[model samples]
Target: MLKFTQNKTPKLNFKKALKKPIPVKCVQIDEPFEVETMEGVMKGKAGDWLMIGVNDEKYVCDASIFKKTYELMK
Candidate 1:
């Protein structure tokens, strides 16, 4: 049988973890883009950029894009 014992030294430094900053990248959108939606489809206009979500899971797009797409559907 093996017995487990706690180490006298602490495992991690809390100070270092707090000082670290999360990594993120800023992307620029220069042209119109399109996205699919449950209702139908959506679009993004040129000259519009968004502070996208981490790992490209989400993003901010131009308001006009959504408006145009809705109008077209109607």
Candidate 2:
């Protein structure tokens, strides 16, 4: 019996989606805390961002990434 191997073809072009920036309520955690998210409970550390989504869902975001991704609304 002979076994054949399948070769995968790569796509030449990639599609990109435009993301709109929407504001959400977020607060910086002063101490370690746990937030109950839709997925499950998530742990947040001090200086991290605890975001409350439009649906009132809570989630944690790293401080570094948050700073880079979000800016204060003036």
- Please provide, for model 1 over 1-74, each residue's C-alpha lDDT reduced to its tens digit, 9 standing for 90 to 100: 85546765455554644423434433446888765544456665675544334555444455555344322211
Q: lDDT: which candidate is best?
A: 2
Looking at candidate 2, the ten consecutive residues that score lowest on lDDT are 3-12
Q: List pairs with backbone clashes in candidate 1.
A: none
TM-score of each: 0.31, 0.76
Residues 52-73, model 2: lDDT tens digits: 8888888999999998889978
Give candidate 1 misplaced runs (Cα > 4 Å): 1-24, 36-41, 63-74
For model 1 the local lDDT of residue 54 reads: 51
> In model 2, what are the clashing residue pairs, if there are any?
none
- CA-RMSD of model 1: 16.3
Q: List ranges where model 2 is wrong by over 4 Å.
A: 1-12
